[model samples]
Target: MTGAPITADRLASLTTYREVVQQPAVWREAAETLAARSDEVAAFLEPLFALPDLRIVLTGAGTSAFAGEVLAPALARTLRRRVDAVATTDIVSNPREMFAEDVPTLLVSFARSGDSPESVAATQLAASCLTSVHQLVITCNPEGQLAREHSGSNSSLVLLMPSATNDRGFAMTSSFTSMLLSAWLALAPDQDPRLAERLAAAAEQVLGRPDELARLTGRPYDRIVYLGSGSLGGLARESALKLLELTAGKVISYYDTPLGFRHGPKAVLKDGTLAVVYLSNDAYTRRYDHDIVEELRAAIGSENVLAVSAQSDDAESWQIDGVSDVDDAVLTLPFVVIAQLLALRFSIALGRTPDNPFPDGEVNRVVQGVTIHPLQP
Candidate 1:
């Protein structure tokens, strides 16, 4: 017997699958939102850029927090400033240390629903802790606490993601990349206006050929490790989390930078382990990334390792074309689509519901049960 064809429409039975496939189209919409708000974003940021000592901090919680991790290094390089990816979870619990320096700071918050407890608390914490702090709220929900509360404030700018990105599924699929892309275009200097189009084109190509990633699901491996370097390091962290979330933690996933994995974390490899390397686009960084791929292959057999890359340097890679010579940061936009597809296929393979892996509410679409302890400035 054969199976029903897999498509955004055919997969409508599972919102997660639908959203995963819909991301490329949604990203094109995200590009338009940033283009429409480009002037306002610049008017709000130019003065902050002039302050030579400005510190840009990106913050969020859980998967949302990972968005900051991916963007921080790339943005720091582009803007040439002290950019840090600090989680809102870290800020609420230890606002003082997180805001210790009291330098002029720009806090960019990324959220899907924007209603998470830490999302609002961290913004308030930044406003009170630092003498000079500005905020850029990049979120999917227009009515979320972050968007609603910060909409009119002179000290901040609110950039609403394409509303379709307010993902309805239990996990964040469209929201993650859209918010990441929106922030990059709005804040990065001299961004190619065509980058988003390129990203969409690449992602569409990935969405077109899901069979390679789907084939990995047939393997007997139960543990997966994702590794990359620099900005791709953050993408590694996110890819790990996506698998964990979609699998309801039934499958173990680990993440680290290629260099850091050698420091002891490589022990996660075993008989049932599979390693996925997210290759870097930088010639220098690519060397370290390639080293780890070879090491992982040696430890877990060549067939158990998969190299994901935009370049075809590796004969064993899952190649993504349509994007040419993009930076690792930009490469992340489409590469992540590969991760999202794998998680979806793996979830179904494990007899899990891709729509709501935790039907019992073990976890939620928007986090629950985080109490915001009031802090006095």
Candidate 2:
């Protein structure tokens, strides 16, 4: 059965679809929220940057973790500091390995709910382990424990995104993108004046052509591979999770960088696997992406490979026109929408509810059944 365009009425009936469609508007709101508070954010971060031994750790779980992964490379380049993307789950499990006592660390926590046990525990662990640690909580939920606990701290700053970004769906659609944009705008130097407008326009272009991309999800592919480079590689990881989460694990997925895929991960490719490659704008990186697409097309045929690019001469590529001038870092905003739409369509195609793909209580919006262990002093 071929997928169809999700209409207004249909979108209204599903929380996931509604959140997905409402993303562009929320992104603008998030940008405005950050812009109005840029000076305050700068004030909070500037002093930490002045510290000679400062290290920035971007930490979160699941989609939130991927947000840090997407921003870490670009932020490290902009700040000229050692920036690391670490998952809260990992931090909670191995606090000693992830945190050091000598380095003055900035723990930038990204969380949709901010209430996750790992999120709270990781923040506590950082404070306990590092002698000089500052916390920056970027979360959608203002009332979450992470926000309320650190709101008045001298060493912590909690930046709450627009309230609409507190996603109501099982999967994070608006929440993920809004927080990603908020962090990018908050941290990047010489912020683009036209970023909000360009992001909205680019998102609208993708939103208008859902059917074109939805049809691609209708094929009989049991496995999907998402590939990209640098910041886009983090996006590929998020994209893979979206499909896996929205489909309730019915469709197996894998994500890797274009170069990394050739290093044994490409073995996952099979007869029923569909490969989605996000081509980079960097001249050097684009060559690797293009070569992978060519090689995949030859191996699995064009029907199984989908190439998403801002500028590509390939006839089979999904060219996102008019945004070629945007930097690949910022372009991640619209590029992610393609993955969101595919997950929604694939969920429907598999006879699963996108809003709650796993109604049996196997997985949840906020993770369950996790025990936080006391760190040994």
Candidate 3:
């Protein structure tokens, strides 16, 4: 079964496939839950947000870290405060650097199991180092260490994702989007009023057309580069990771901002490599993205480059439908679906099981083998 064509029956049996397909519905449910609990969430956050010099840090590991990166820019703009997306791995490795300032800080942790050693240690380090620190844990597992420890703390708030999002599969699909949507709703409730509907519509369109998407994945390219700008740059990073993980490193994948690629990264482009540029809705940023799309097309041939856009003005592009003119953060929802499907298809193409690409336990689902050394003051 390994490295063979994945038949329909086999595909149906894979948890990754079901998780990927269930995302749109999961997003809608998550949005509705967040909306219903808006007042309570607001009540808990209002005072903390009211602090004039509040500092917000979004922390998580792996895919969870990318969520913070994707949400930070837009949240900072909306809240008019300093917002940072730092990985828990970084926080544990260098607590003094991460928590040097004793300012009032809000550590928003995005976790799937809420049990990653770094996840727990980062929160602990924040409380230890900061004089006035609050925690907002957006996690899938309610029983995990993070949720259990922070459950009743006046300074901590735990928002559990939809139960199904805990993700039985090794790779995180629904959990990432679920936590991202939930965090956006909690942090910036006023923006993107129709985010859930628009995201669900666009994602449904992508999910309904697997055959067409499979065609794109069927290409012989062995290397992939995903490019974006601003919030979409974080999206691009996650997209590249999905491909690399789902293929179990069989494919070499890279990610960079549309403009950043020009500096030295462009040297990586050559035969057997494909570039997927995520075109931004912001006209200003889109220009740079468009420039790269054109450059990659000229360099690698149009057949080897793909433009993921909402406008879809070009020939070789995947247009996310019904979510046009939205913020790049909202667009990431549908954009990620395209990447998830691509990764799944690529996994099948290489005869790797999408559910468990690392059957030998080389890379566990929740991540393992990290010793959390006590951070000395």
Candidate 4:
């Protein structure tokens, strides 16, 4: 069967698919929200940015953590400041190692649902461990603990995303992309006025090509590999997780940089593996990406390897049209749509509901069963 349009029945049957398809619209709303509240966001951040020897930490758990991974490299370059992407899981587990008492720090926390135990714990732990600490909470849930506890505080600012971005599905789709776009807008020094429009256009183009992607996923592949570089490497990781999460771990997945994959990780490749390479726009990085695609195609046949790029020579390549001028980091917003759609399609193909794949409760929308321990004085 070809890819199905997201009709009312599809929405009822696969809510996760709907969330995935609606991300481009959510991204536009998020951009508008950030643009409207730009002054407020700036007021909270400008003073912190001026501080001498300040440290910036981008943090969250799971997919939220990947958000930081995707943005940290580009933000550091754009701001000419030191920025680190750390998971809230690391903070909650080892706060002492992750934070210092003397350094002034800005913890940019990304959370789809602010209620995650690690999310709250990480914020509180940062506040207690650092002598001077400020927080920027970017979350989809306005009523979530992360938003409610930190709002109105002199040291912290909470930016709630668009209402539709607070996704109801099992996996985070709109919430993830929306929060990602918000961070891009917040940190970019010279904002591009047309970026949001370009992102929406690019995503709509990808969304319209679901039949091609559906046919690709229709193959009986048991393993999926995603490869990229720099910020795209982080996106590759997130893309791997999307398939794993939606499939309830039925399909094995791996992610790495195009160059790094040859270092022992290439052993995972076999007859049933599908390699999805996100080609870089930079001439230098694109060479490595292209080399890998050529090597993989030669070794495992061209049909098993897929290349996603803003520029492509092959007719089979999944080209993200209308975004050639956008920065590669910004292009990740549309690149992710391909991954989301593939995961949703694979989930349906496997006879699982994309909304909530794990019926046995081994995994959950909001993680549970963790006991928060107090730090010893």
Q: lDDT (CA) for every model shown?
A: 0.87, 0.88, 0.89, 0.87
In model 2, which runs have C-alpha deviations exceeding 4 angstroms? 1-8
Candidate 1 ranges with C-alpha deviation above 4 Å: 1-10
Screening candidate 4 with a backbone cut-off below 3 angstroms (N, C-alpha, C), the clashing residue pairs are none
Residue 275 Cα positional deviation in candidate 1, in Å, after optimal superposition: 0.7
Worst 10 residues of 3 by lDDT: 1-10
Model 2 over residues 246-269: C-alpha lDDT tens digits? 999988989999899999998998
Q: Pick the candidate with the highest lDDT.
A: 3
Question: Over the stretch 1-377, how does candidate 3's per-residue lDDT look in tens digits?
Answer: 13345567877888998998899899999998888888889988999988999999999999999999999998998889999999999999999999888899999999999999999999999999889999999999999999999999998988988899999998999999999988988898566767888888889988777776666676777889999999999999999999989999998999999889999999989888978888998898888888988889899998888798888676668777787777887788889988898888888888888899999999899879999887664
TM-score of each: 0.96, 0.96, 0.97, 0.96
- Model 4, residue 113: displacement in angstroms? 1.1
Task: Compute the lDDT for candidate 4.
Answer: 0.87
Model 1, position 217: C-alpha lDDT score: 73
Q: Write the per-residue lDDT of candidate 1 for residues 1-377, one digit (tens) a residue.
A: 01223454545678787788788888899898788877888899999999999999999998889989998888888888899999999999999999999899999999999899999999999999999999999999998989999999999999888878899988888999999988888888887788888999989988888677656777766889999899998899999999999988878999999999989998899987879899988888989889988888888898889898888788888888866588787788898988888887777777788788999998988889988888864
Tens-place lDDT digits, model 4, residues 292-345: 999999988899998999985556678887787666778898999889988887
- The model with the greatest TM-score is 3
TM match of model 1 to true structure? 0.96
